[model samples]
Target: MEIYETQEENAWIFRIDGRLDSNTAPELETTVFRAIENGARRMVIDFEALAYISSAGLRVILKTAKDLKRLDGKLVLCAMQDYVREVFEISGFDTFLPIAPTAGDALRQVAPPKE
Candidate 1:
C-alpha cells in the first residue's frame, strides 16, 4: 500500500492506497509507530483509496489505537470504501475506533477544541 502522510496543525493524517495485507501491514505499522515515537498525538487514517484490508491490517490498526491510548493520544479513521467499512463492521472495530465520513471530519475529531 502507498501511505502518504501530512500534518494539519497538530494532527497527522495518513492516506492509504491499494491493499493492506500481511506484507504491507508491517510497512504501515512501522511508519505509524515512528510517527508516534516522534511525538505525534493526533492521527487520522484516510482509507479512501484503500482497496482491501486483511486481518493483519486490522491488527496494525488495533495496535496503533492501543499505543495511542497509552500515550493519551487519539486516532480517527475516515473515507473508507464499502468493503473496508464492512470489514470493520464485521470485525467490530467500528464500535471502538472512530470512523468518520471524510478526512475533514476525522481531522476535526482529532483536533483540540478551540478556545
Candidate 2:
C-alpha cells in the first residue's frame, strides 16, 4: 500500500491506495502511529482507492482510534467501498470509529483546539 499524507489547516490527511493486509499493515500502522505521535489530533484517512484489508489492518485502525481517544484526538475514515465497509460494520468498528461520506465531511467532524 501507498500512503500519501498532507495537511489541511490543522487536520492531517492520509490517503491510502492498494491493499492493506498483513504484508503492509505494519508499514501503514507505523506511518499513522508516527503521525499521531507527532501530534496529529485530527486525522482524515481516505480509503477511496483501497481494495482490501485483513484482520491485521482492522487491528491497526482500532488501535489508532483508541490511542487518539486517549489524547482527546479524532480519527475519521472516508470513501470506503461497500466490501470494506461491510467488514468494518461486521467487526463492530463502524460503531467505534467514525465514518463520513466524504473527506470534507470527515474534516468538518473534527473538534476544535487539537485540530
Candidate 3:
C-alpha cells in the first residue's frame, strides 16, 4: 500500500492507496507510530484509493486509535468504499471511530473552525 501523508494545522492526513494487509500493515503501523512518537496528535486516514483491508489492517487502526486516545488526540477515517465500510462495520470499529463520507468531512472533523 502507498501512504501519502500531509500535515494540516493540527492534524496529519494519510491518504492510503492499494491494499492494507498483513505485509503492508506493518509499514503503515511504523509510519503512524513514528508520527505519534514525534508528537503528532490528530490524524485522518483517507481510504479513497484503498481497495482492500485485512484483519491486520483493522488491528493497526485499532492500535492507533487507542494510542491517540491516550494522548487525548483523535483519528478520523473517510472516503471508504461500500465493501470496506462493511468490513469496519462488521469489525465493530465504526462504533467508536469517526467515519466520514468524504475527505472534506474528515478534515472538518480534525480541522479548526473558520472565523
Provide the lowest-lDDT 10-residue window in model 2: 106-115
Candidates 1 and 3: which is better by TM-score? 1
> Model 1's lDDT to the true fold?
0.95
TM-score, ranked from best to worst:
1, 3, 2
The residue-by-residue lDDT of candidate 3 on 1-115, one tens digit each, is 8999999877899999999999999999999999999888899999999999999999999999999989988999999999999999999999999999998889889765567
The numbered model that scores best in lDDT is 1
List, residue by residue over 3-115, the lDDT tens digit for candidate 2: 99999986899999999999999998999889987889888899999999878999998888888889988899999999999989898889978999998888888746442
lDDT of 3: 0.93
Least accurate stretch of 10 residues (summed lDDT) in model 3?
106-115
Q: Model 1 reaches what TM-score against the true structure?
A: 0.97
Look at candidate 1 and tell me the lDDT of residue 29. 97
Scanning candidate 1 in windows of ten residues, the lowest lDDT window is 105-114
Candidate 3: which stretches are off by over 4 Å? Answer: 112-115
> TM-scores, in order shown?
0.97, 0.93, 0.94
Count of backbone collisions in candidate 3: 0
Deviation (Å) of 84 in candidate 3: 0.7
Candidate 2 or 3, higher TM-score?
Answer: 3
Model 3 residue 40 distance off true place after TM-score fit, in angstroms: 0.7
